[model samples]
Each structure stands twice: as structure tokens, then as C-alpha cells.
Target chain A: MPSDSTIQVRQVDRYRWLVPKQGPMRVDGLVFADRRLMADVRGDQALQQVVNVATLPGIVGHSIAMPDIHWGYGFPIGGVAAFDPDEGGVVSPGGVGYDINCGVRLLRSDLVVGDIRPKLRELMNQIMRDVPAGVGVGQRDLRLGPQDLLGVLEKGARWAVEHGFGVPADLDRIESGGALSGADTAAVSPRALERGRKQLGTVGSGNHFVEVGYVDEVYDEHAAHVMGLDLDTVTVFIHSGSRGLGHQVCTDFIDVMLRATAKYGIDLPDKQLACAPLDSDEGKLYLGAMNAAANFAFANRQVMMHGVREAIERVLGRSWTKLGLDLVYDVAHNNAKWEEHQVDGRRRKLCVHRKGATRAFPPGNAELPAAYAEIGQPVLIPGDMGRYSFVLAGTERASQETFASTCHGAGRQMSRTQAKKSVRRDGRDLRREFEEMGIEVRAASFATVAEEIPEAYKDVADVVDVVHQAGIGRKVVRLRPLGVLKG
Target chain B: MEDPLGPGVREVEHTADVGIVVEASDFEQLLHRAAVGVFALMYGKADADLGPTDLFNPLGTRVHLGASDDQGNQAGMPRPITVVGSDPAAILLKWLRELLFLHETEGLAYRRATFDVVDEERVSATVWMGPEPTPAACEFKGVTYHDLDVTPGVDGWRARVILDV
Candidate 1:
């Protein structure tokens, strides 16, 4: 048997590469990338993470890496793996990531590019004023009382609608209907609650954004129309998560899982992949708290969407309803959920961990909302601020091969320090560069804007093409930014 | 403000997040340097670029958490800080995480620390605090254990830690 040091990657097809299982790995590692993208994948330590994930207990099928994969703590950013509990499967906090339920929410509006171009700056400024952002910025106006906070933990997005943060119909368009079941508030710690109290609706720090854009192209007209997309139609994308609550949840549980890992004799290739049996007391407690954190995230996006609506209303002198601002869908990229999938021609219950990946349930999947049941789940992929973002649909091939998951975003190519240093050396005015492209930019700091320069990431178009060509996801529409608010 | 490259702390690059590699004369100094490195990442080391201050000062507005007096002593009242873990690496991770939490909730940026007791499994210190500045180059979500290490070498001590942003 070849040792992990000698692990070899063989090309399976134009868009697929396979790392045959060896060493302690229980399954193969499959990566979706074209030659050009594959070169970048091999440049980082992400491939090692994929191999490490395959060594986890009870992992089913292949440990997959999407085209946008990049080096991340514990697991590669675009890694997806599912574990079978009946086969001594384990649940890991690292698999879900520090930001539990970190995800994207898309909102479609009736206004077109022509309607918003005149007041784009005003709209962006209003959004910047309305939403609390940047490092350690918490909501001043929307502090949740203890009981209300508990309701949010228990009800997720429904709590926001019930509290008048949004409309009731918004729940229908969210993954897991905006709330996962079995969230126990008791499982959450006091420290986690304290950290999240004032941060419910704030867009906390790095890479989180609220972007205003217009649909520039529609590849699948039928699917586009179903999701309220049309040429030049204005849209808003909110990328955020459960904030400190989620981070603290993952932090609190990692320590528990570490101790449990020793208790259960679960050997791990990395300390960050620390885990316990799915049925263990430690595992159940973590799931309960994680679900609570996920709920906090769902409510967070809902609250922010409401803020965006109010910002638009203030700018346009029309109610959000009159502007036809509606939530298209919300998808959580960082999560672990119990799912049923066919394994070796037999249906088995599995816990799927998607870190920096999106769930791509195919057409006819019972989990999809009725509006999208015929098309497939709307997979929201947000690119960097300057470039274009894509809307993709789930495919059957993905369900069979990857536990129905797809890429999350345009992964980073340069380190944050490198991006900053390059920007300084080139003397590029990021604000002017963005404005030159006709995109209005409002940021919490110039340093953030510099670190997040467009060149810092891979062209998302290339990543999306790989997913489309590989039949894991299908292209629907492409959106180009008009304005962005970053923290 | 102390130099970001003050021989004890240096920034390490990560694809998606940020980290620091720290070295010092001993474990206590290693812990102090790590805190400085992390706070410097959140609030740039230069006094001119401390950026905008947050609205609330839950720590009651010390005015110079990241600043030092003419005599080279850090400001703010020194408070007790104690943390425990399985090993030195774990202890460091927990210490960094504790400082991160304090920075977020109470706006306490690290000033300095006087180690009372420090070992592989535990650390107790009298930590000086300060208010956190906003509009930082970035924000870190949490400290992670991935690839974390803390070790003693002939040249003193060394540690590496990655933070999730």
C-alpha cells in the first residue's frame, strides 16, 4: 500500500481528478477542477486536508473538493464529506467550521439597472448607515432581550418574521425553512449568549458583505423566471453568519470534542478534526448547540435583509413592497446535517458536513420548495466584489457523486498579507478602481478594501464553469455588482 | 506602539485566514508576545492608524489600551486571567481565544500580562487591558487549533497559531 506521502492524483476526466485511497484513509479523495484550476488546487495544502478527511471514521463515498478549494483550518474550505452513524460515524466541529451556518441570502427586486443607477451611491450610503459593520460592530437599535434571544435560538428566521423583522412568506425560501429542529437553548452557554446579544443583525468583519447588483445574463430562462430573475433586474446578496454566537459555539465544542476524542479512542489525523461518536453525549450536546447557533444565523440574515429593505425604502421613497424586494433563497454553506442518501445501492442515513460548500439538492428532491421543485435548489455563489457572481441549480450527478453539494464562492488565491502588500506596492486606489468599473463601494476601512481587492481571488467564472461542465451544478444566471458594503 | 516585528512576534500568511509565529526567552514572554501579535493584527501597531474607536467602551475608556507610558509601562489596571488546557499549545489557543472574546464583548485589547503561573496545561496571569479600535484591516472570528504548536527550543520558546477570520 502506498503511504500518504506517496499519495498520487490521477486524472479521471477533463474536470475530475481522483486520489486513490491509501494509508489510513477509508475512502478516495475526488476533486472537481479543470487543468488550470487544478494547478492552483495543488499549490496549497488543501489536497492534504482532503486526504485527511478521508481518514475520518465512517466516511462514505469520496472525500470531495470543489474547484474553489483552498487551505483552511482542519478541513479544506471547499471540502464535503458524509459519515454514516451506524458504521461508527463521528460528528466533528471542524467539519462545520468556526462560523456555523455562515451562508448567503439573495433578494430580488423589481427595479432594473436603469431604475437604480441614478441613486446607486445614495442607496449604498444608506445601506452602510443602516447596517452595523466592521470589526466588533454590534447592533445599536436591535438588541434582543434574554427571552427574545431564546426565541430566536429556538425559532430561527421565523422569530425575525414574528418579531416584524420580515414577512412570514420569507421562511418558505430558506433552507430548512429558516430553522433546524432540535435546537436546545440549554445546550448553549452563557458566554455564547453574552457575545451574541447585541450582534444579532450586525455584519461582523472579514469577507462578509451586502452587495447590490443587477442580473446581467440568464442562461436558463425558465429557472431564472421561477426565481424572479430577469435581465438587468436589481438584486441584493447578504453574506454573513451567526456572528460571535456561532464562533463561540464551535470554540466551546471543539474543546469538548477534543476530550471526547480521547475518551472514545477516536484517532484523528489532525487535532482540529477532533470528534466523538454521533450517539455520544458530547456529540448530542454539540449538535443541540450548533443547531441553536444555526438558528441565530438564519435570524441574522433575515434581520439584515429587513435592514436592506428599509435602506432601499429610505433611498427610493417607496415601500419595499412597492419596490418588489423579495427573498429568492437563503443557503447555509457551513453546516452538518442528517441526510438520507443511497450508498452502494442501499439507502443509509448519513451526517453530511459541508464546509465552504452549498447544498445542491436536485430537481424532484423533497427538500426543495414547491417553487423550485421542478428546477432544483437555487445555489447562491457570491464572487468577489468587483467581478460577477453566478446562480446555479442542483444536478442529479452531484446527488449521486458528492452527497448533493457544490462550490461556495470564488476562493481566495492570495493571502491577506500578500493582497495588502501587492496593493501597496502597485499604489492602486481600490476605491477608484471599483468606481471606474461603475461599481459604488462603501467600506468600513480602506485596509479592508485593500485586503479584499478583486485580484485576491480566483475568477469565479472559471470555478462555476468547472461545476457546470462536471455536471454537479447547472448555470442559471450571472449577476454583476452595482454597489457593495463591506466590513 | 511596539514594533510588529519586535523579534518576538511576526505575522504568518494563510490562504484564507491570518496567523502569527512567536518566539521569546521563555514561556511567559511567548504568551505575552502572542497576545501583542494578535491585537496588532486587529488594531494596527502604529498609533497613527489606530482607526476609529467603537461607540461603547464597556471597559470604561482607558484611552490607551494599545499605548504605553513614557516609562514603557502599558496603561490600564492589571486584572487576573487564568486559563487551562491539555498542553502548552492548547493553553495558548485558549489564552488567545479568551483575549479575542474579551476584545469583542468588552472591547478589551491586550496591553501586557504578568505571568503568575504557566505550564503545559495551565496559565495564570495579571493581564492589563485597553479599548479596541474599530475599522481594523480585518476581523478574526475565532482562534483555531489547526496546526497549532508551542515548544521549547535551545533559543528559548516558539509557537504558531492560526486564527479564523
Candidate 2:
């Protein structure tokens, strides 16, 4: 057979390319990136993955990549696709990623930017110190027993809220109400259970972070107002996910599916996309385990919010309730879910795979919370600690088109190693750089600090603009970083 | 003899979808071979033989990747793989993982790879998606890198890659 090198590349526009369908590919691969980004992206193997995903069984629409697309296992990061279960479509871990429901949440404060700038360092510092970080550093040394853990897997942040991690209103702003049902702890391994026992309230390392910021700019006045954003308003952002426990769950099942492939007799272009029929016992087991981890992530973030509230109270010497540290919204980035969408003009249920992407359900969708349904789902996109983040609302355009998914954040512009090397050469102290930017910074490790320097990522503003212009999601508020806690 | 360090990528089959491990002297080389191996199973070829004139030899591998199960809802379990290797290291690991995944999912198999060095983190290879290597068995769902250990060798370069499967 002709080698993969025989694969052809066709530029479709200034920011998109086509990996033509040849060989076993079922559809063409589409990449979204400016010429500048594409040059670097093309040099990576992610394009091949995009092409490879097209060959999967029953993948509908385009196997698409966001501008932040980067090389990843099985499926490329920032990739999206939909599959039909009736057609033998398969869900691949490589498609959703390891951080089950790892995502971003934006909190809008009633306070203005100027009011907090002078106290930015203290605010950021308090949040950073209070939130548990690093790998497996438990919250107040809290541990979950089987019963408590199972309850959490089912109720998610609701459990945390009931226990005082947050209030009832917080659920109104959460995607899937902070709990994705169908979490079967039985699918989980003891190892995964052990690792997650104390980690539910902690932030895991690599790309996970919490930041404090102020609204810098607003593009769509109506949309921004609908999103509860005003110029210079203070906001807080949390980006993290299910930690080691989730990783173990995935590890627990990769083996199970390997056998399923043989039973189902499906052909695979990439092994990382291992799977069984959706109705198989193996599939059900994996789904249960994955959901449990997802619930864990939601609960973890909720407790961290509580810790942030406590820290705020400690620093400001006032109650968070009085200060008004309320959640604006939370959205998962890398995940897979069952949803109803228009397929060939019919409301068909399908498995939507959004890896490094967020669901931007348009306004009027019944799924959104009462308050936000009028504005649509809140899409929280976080930028690098040194850059700015944005709040957006889903659009009908997105729902009718790309399965209500949009790009997650500023895609990587430079490799972490390359960023490190360049910083080393330029004598840039990652810790000091954020300080100079007037953004408080804390980290679990200096290496990670150095590796995630703001320069390492593409200008997130550009990424948010793409989706906004494309009408997938409309801009709401602009969050400029004040401080960051990294892991 | 059984490979004590779990199964090396070499043990990965096209259709078994089994996860395998790959090691290299350095991060860059490890990623290089891993990428090679992932793609190797898809196009079906031994990427080792296609270096020099083929693969683009970029300088690095930097990206965050996650894998998930196919079931919708909470069933969509994702696993992350963090690797950095040059052509040889990346190609092998990449090919093997891809083969292992295919084996677990589709029950396909192919023996070799043809690698084209695109850069340090990127490689292009053709894999021969052969017929099923094993019949009436399980499929590999995904691969994950957790508490992954990659230590530099005495040669001052080393890597440890673990697949969740």
C-alpha cells in the first residue's frame, strides 16, 4: 500500500486545510488555523490524526480541528466529531481526552476592576494558597468513603453544594448542572479509586489553572450585557478537571476495549481510539467509570470554589456572601456526551465528541439553566495567565451547524520545550514575568511555571475572535488576568 | 520471554487494540518514536526504514493529548499521553499505540511502518491496516500517561512511557 507520506494536503482558505479522503478515510479532515499557525501545525502529526479520525466508523459531519489544534493521542487535541450509534459509531478516549470533563468556569463579580486592582495581589494570593494544588494534595486532608464517593459521582457539585462547598444558585450556572448522570462507580478500578480518594478537591498539573481577572473589553454590547459582563468588572476563572482518578479509570478500561475490538471486528486506523459497541458490557463499564470521574472533576472544582471563597473572606476580612463571589458559568472542554441534534433535518440522538472544545448551546435551548437560557449557554474560554480570557454565549448558528461546539482556548503557539529553551536563552524567569505583568502567580513546580509561560500559547484573543466571527459563540466579557495559581 | 516492563510497543498488534510501552534515551527521541508507532499501525508499515529522505525532522514535541471511551455521557473516559521523542523514538511509540488501539477497536493488524521526519514532534508514516490479528477477543479502548516516569539515562537522556491499556 502507498505510505502515509502519500497523504496529500490541500489548503482550503487562509486558515483551513484539507486532508483528502483516500485509503480507509471516510471523510476529509478539516483544520482551522491561520497560515502562520498552519505552518507550525502542519509540521506536527496532528493533521495525520485528523485524517485518521475520518476513517472511523459512522463519524458524521467533518472531522474538524479548532485553531488551537495540536498533536494528541488517538485523536488530536482541539478535535471534534459526531458518531451514530446505529451505524456502529465508536467513542474513543483519544477523542475526549484524559481530563474527563476538564473545563473552564467564569465567575463575574459585582465589583469593578479599579476596586480590585490595588488588592489584586492579595486577592490572587489568598485564592492560590487556599485552593489545594499539586498532584494529590487533598483538601483539608478530606477523604471519601465508598458511600460518599458514590453519592458524589451521582450528584456531582450538587453534593458539594449541599455540604456547603457552594450554594444552590451555583447549579443554575453550571453546565449539566455540575453533575453528568449515569456515573457508575462500579466501572472504576480500586487503583483509580485510591488515587482519587483525596484528590477530588485538588487541581491536577499541566494546563490546569485558576486565575483572577478584570473585564478589559467587550465586543458585542447586547451579548456582553446578556452575559452579565461590564467593562472593568472583576472575574475569576478556574480551569481544571478530574485528576489521577480519572487517568486510572481510563487506564483501567483501555485493556477491556482491546478485546472488544476483536469481538466487534471493526477496522481501526489508530489504536488509541479503542472501543466496543455502545451496547456492549465493556462499553457500559467504561461509560460508568468515565462518568464517575467526570462527576469527580465537577465536585473537585466546586470545593476549590469554596476554598476560594474562604480565602477571599480571610484576605478581605469580609464574608464572600457579602463580597458576592458568584459563579457565572462552567463548561467542559474535553469530553463526550449524548445529545440531540439536527441530523439531515431530523432530531437524532448522537454521541458528540468535543476534545479541547466546548459546547455552545444556542439561546432558547431547553438544556440551559433558567437564567441563562435567555442568553444561551455560557462558554468560558481561558487564556494564558498573562493574556486575557472571554465569556461567550452559544448561538443558534452553532447549534444548527457544528454540533454546538466551539474552540476551547488559545492553542499552543510554541512547544513547551521550545518555550523553555527560548526562555532559558532569553533569561526569562517565568515566575518573575507574571509578577511584572501584575498577575500574582503560584505553581506546584518551577518547571511547569517555566514551561507554561504566556508566550508559549497563541493569542487567545485571536482564537475567541474566530468563533465569534463564525457565529458559533458570541463574545460576552473580556477577562484580563490579575493573578494565577498553576499546577 | 515476557517483556517485564509491560509489553513493549513491539508486542502491540493492529487488531488487538492492546496498550504497549515504549522507552527512549531522551524526551524528544521518545516522542519521535511514539508518534511513529501511533501512525505506523494506521498506514501499516515499519517506520524505521523510511527516515532521512522521508520524515520531517523538526526540533521538538509539545502538545497535550487526552483519550476517551466511545460511550456518550460519563462513559466518555479520556486518557492523556504526554511524550516527546525524535524520529526513531516518536515513530515507534506512536505506531505501536496506534496499532494497539486499532487491535482493541477494529481488530485490524499490519506489521510495519514507513516514516517521514516532519519535525521533532511530527512524523508521517504509512501503516498497513492488515486483517484481524486475533479473533473473538477484546478491543483496546485507549492509552493514558499518568504518573508516567521518564528518567534520563546514563547517557544523560531517558524516557518512560506507559499506556493506560
Candidate 3:
């Protein structure tokens, strides 16, 4: 196994390192990290995956990695790569990950920290009951028939809004207006459809959660204000994805892409990177299916948000609307989208894949909603439940360097087995530990909490600092979790 | 029945997700042990126990066994489980994916599995769908081909797999 000392890296700047393009690589690899984080990154196989990605046909700029980069299947988590369709660039299922459009949503409320402190336990219990969580646990009330499921695939979050889960205005605050265009229901498989039928409005286990927090500090006052964030104001964060539907979609497409890879004669360094040309029949089908899955994910989070609103209202004895519980913004961390970026001084159309990275579009980008045109896109980075999360704003430097991408989260620092072993060896009571910190945590099982211990992840503040220093994203506000509900 | 391969599995360290290493005296035993390892990882050893069952009615009358022609409706059926692949590696991948799908969609936890036919190209197994178990510690999204290997070693047949959680 290659170690930190074995990997070759040339320092590009204080925050950027270049893995010089060599061997079969078509482009250089760029990783953004400071000295301390770079040491951790080099200790894993993530940089090697970056090099493998560079070997893919039609790669643009550099195979990029955010500071939070870690070992993943084909592309490292926190890896971003763009491909030119006209140049035989392809889309790989591994690049988008299994949980299609797995993303985060933030909801800001009028209530201050003082108002929710005393009722935090009640509110957490309310959310735990209202939201179906854990593996295979679905909302019995939200089950969809075949036809209704098709509507979700086609309309994404709009389906939830039309179903009266939320108002149509919520759609505008979401990326791609809560639905990706060109989603073809017919392209989705029966298994995928079946898996999605009863799984809507669920938070599946492992790192996914519904967190209640407060804005503890504001780094960029103007941007924070634009995002409806105020110091000491309570907020809600939903972290989940399309559930079984998306996993089935990715599984189905991997078989398709494997065949496509052979037909296109594309040699692969890793089978997980199986792909086909973007314009090929196989590629187009995968894209359509993937988009449909992405839509389902959008609707899943939207529905869950509705449930959260209901829970909050029931607990507070006030209507959600009356409390000003409105969505601030929603962004997908796992997806591939057709975007235009400047390359070699020429504007080119490319398909950008962000596996475990978030889109950080600069202010003035036409894609920004009118309200955020001056403040840039709102980026929510949720840290471990015990510590604090951050809100960031997209920067012009990100657009110029990394196809407008930034780190997703703190990223896992320890394996699940390692975490469990540590907990058992030390005989630590994870729940009591969190309670000691004054954070209430309700989970399906204590084992889940042990695996998700704050020690298992890097300090998100450090991750955020690297991106902020690299100028990919600018820090806006810091959020401290008061209560958390996990599956 | 005398065992041809010793039964044992261990969790391997993976940076992001869960990884397991399974070993047996032959390929068939390796597959069985891998399934055991997966269930153990999801729910722990106490809940991973398997009950004895007849092959013809492995899941009993509780599960409906019928073939669905429509692709979307396939996950609705719980039996007559037949999986085909081009090679041993593909077969392993398909088998693991099927187990994950069943666990995620049907709420079926397998306590025992009996393979009627096992080869490089096809596998037919009757998995006894036991009572729904407690919530798993973690949810495995899917199996990946990343660094997946199934080969014969000096001890027996060995396989390594990574599960996306």
C-alpha cells in the first residue's frame, strides 16, 4: 500500500498542491489543502484516485480535490472533474455516488436560541416521531403507487409542493429549482421505482440526520443577512438523499456502463470508474435515469422538510408559516450536471461531476436566484453533531479554479470498524458523552452514535478554513447543534 | 455434513465505508460467509443467527413467491431467487446486491440460505426470510466493484468486498 511518503506532490501555493500529470494521465491533478490537512490526505488512496480520474478521456483543467478529500470507490470523496462531451468525455456512476443527489437543506426560523432551549428535548422527540428514519423504515402514510411514483421521478420536489407539503415558493430556493430538467420516468427501472415507492420522507441510517441548531456567529455579516441567518436564531438542517431508489439506479447503471465501456474501448484503471461517452446511447440513458433518481431525491428532502415543519408547529403550538419557518437554500453534493466553464480562455460546455463536493457558484453567476445574486450561492457544511457546522458563500476564485466546487463536510477520518473498536475498547458511553456537552441526541441505536462519534471526523472548522483560505468558498456563519435526530 | 471450509469473516479497515474479508475452502463457502459477514456488520452477531429451513419453502408461506415480468415490480417478489452473471466476480457482486435489495425494500432478514446451484455463470439460492430484525447500526447503500477480488488462496477461496454505507 502506498503511504504519504510514497505519493509525489509539488507545491503550487500555500493552499494548492499539484500531482504532476504523468503516466497515462491526460491532465494534472490539483488538490487544495494546507500543510496539516495535506499530511492526512496523503496518508490515503484519495490522491491516487485523483490520478486515475485524470487518465479518463477528455478530462478538463485538473482532477481536483477539496481539503476534505478521502478514499472513495473511483473518485475520491471531495473530488470534482469535468468532461467535454464533444471530446468523448464520459459520465461514470461512481462519480455521482450511489445516493443520487445526496444533499443538504437549511431552514431558518424567526425563533431565537432562547425560545427553543427549554423545549429542545420535546422538539427533538417530535421530529423523531414524525420523520421515518433508519434502514427500511418508511412512512406508511406517504406510500406512492406506480403512477404516483412516476410523478415524483418527473417533477422532483415540485411533486411534494403540489401535494401541499410546501408552497411552490420553496422550489425556487432549491438548486435547479428542486428538479433537474430532462428527467425521463421511462428510463428508470422497475426495481428502482419499487424501492422508492414507500421510502419517501425517510432519513436512512449512517451519517444522515435531522439537526436543530443555532447561528452562533456570523463571519460575513452581509452574506449571512442575505441568507436569512441571524446571530442566535434557531435553524433546522436535513441531511439525506433519494433512499433506495437512488441506490438501485446507480446499481442498475453500473451494469450498463460496464458494457458501454467495452463497446467504447475505454481502458479503465479501476472497474468502478466504468463509463461511456456522454453523447453515446448508453451515456444518454444513464443520464436520464440518474436525473430521474436525482428528482426523487429532491422530492424526498422536500417531503421530509414538510414533516419537520409539522413537527415544529405541533411542538411550538404555532403554525410553521407563522413562525417564519422558510427554506434558505438546498444544494446537492452528489451529482453530474451540464455546466459551462471557462477553459484555456474559452468558454466551453462540460459535464461536471461532484461526488462528495458542493457547488459554490460565485456572486453574479446567472444561475444564482435573484435574491442571492449579490451574495453568491449559500453553501451549508454540517459538521459532526457534537461540535459546530458552517455556512459559506461561493467565491470568484472557485469559478476560476475548480469548476465552482468546494469541500462537502468534515469527511470521515476513521473507519466504521475502527470507531466501533475504539468505543468498545474504551467502554465509552457515547450518549452520555454528548449529553455532557449539553446536546440532546436521539438515535435508533447507540451503535450508530458510536460509529458517528465526533472523533470519527475531522474538525469541520479546519476543513472550512482550507476552502476559505484557498478562496474557493468564503465563510459566512457558524452553527452550533443544540439537538440532533439520527437513524 | 462435514464442513469443507472453516467459517470466519473479519472487518477490514476502509477509509470511507465498510470492508470485509471472507475465507473458505471453496468458492461456495466464501459466498455464504460473505453474506454472514454483511448481516453481522449491519446488525451484529447476536441477530445474525440463522434458523434451519427446507429448500423448497425456505421463506415459508409468509412471503409470496412469484416471478414479475415488469422490472419495477420485481422487488415486490420475495422468492424463486435466481441470479445470473458472466463470471464468479460478477456472480458475487449480483448476489450481494440482491441481498442488500431484499434487506432494504422487503424488510426481509435472512437467517439461513441454501444454494441449489452454484457456478461461475449462475446461482440459485433459497434464502430463509426470518422475522424482521431490529434496526441496523448502519445502512449499506450498495456493493461496489472497487478493489473487489474473489480468488483461490493457499488456505482456500478468499474474497474482499467494499460496501457503500
Task: Tell me the tens digit of each residue's lDDT in model 1 across A221-308.
Answer: 9999999998899999999999999999999999999999999998888889999888899988999999999999999999999999
Among incorrect, acceptable, medium and high, the docking class of model 2 is incorrect
Show model 2 residue runs off by greater than 4 Å.
A1-6, A9-18, B1-165
Between candidates 1 and 3, name the one with more favorable lDDT. Answer: 1
Chain B alone vs. reference chain B, TM-score for every model = 0.77, 0.38, 0.73
Q: Tens-digit lDDT track for model 2 on B80-158?
A: 2332344333433454455554332323343344444434455555444444211211112234432133444666344
Writing each residue's lDDT as its tens digit, candidate 2 over A44-127 gives: 666777888888888877788877776666777789988888877777766777678888887776778777778766666666
Clashing pairs in 1: none
Name the TM-score of candidate 1: 0.95
* Runs off by more than 4 Å, candidate 3: A1-4, B1-6, B46-78
Model 3 TM-score is 0.94
lDDT per residue (tens digit) for residues A1-487 in model 3: 3454655789999999999887899999999999988888988788889999999988999999999899999899999999999788999998999999999999999999999989988888788878877766777577798888999999999999999989998998999999999897888898998788888888888999999999999998888888889899899999999888999999999999999999999999999999999999988999999999999999999999999999999999999999999999999999999999999999999999999999999999898899999989999899998999999999999999999999999998888767777877787766567779888887766667777889899999999999998899999999999998876
Q: What would the per-residue lDDT of candidate 3 be over residues B1-165, giving only the tens digit for each residue?
A: 322112568777888898888888877887788887787677745212221111111112111111121222443233656789888888888998888787766665555677899887899987765433355557889899998988877888888899999
Cα deviation in Å at residue A461, candidate 2?
1.7
Q: Score the docking of each candidate (DockQ).
A: 0.35, 0.03, 0.29
| Best of the candidates, lDDT | 1
Q: lDDT (CA) for every model shown? A: 0.87, 0.66, 0.85
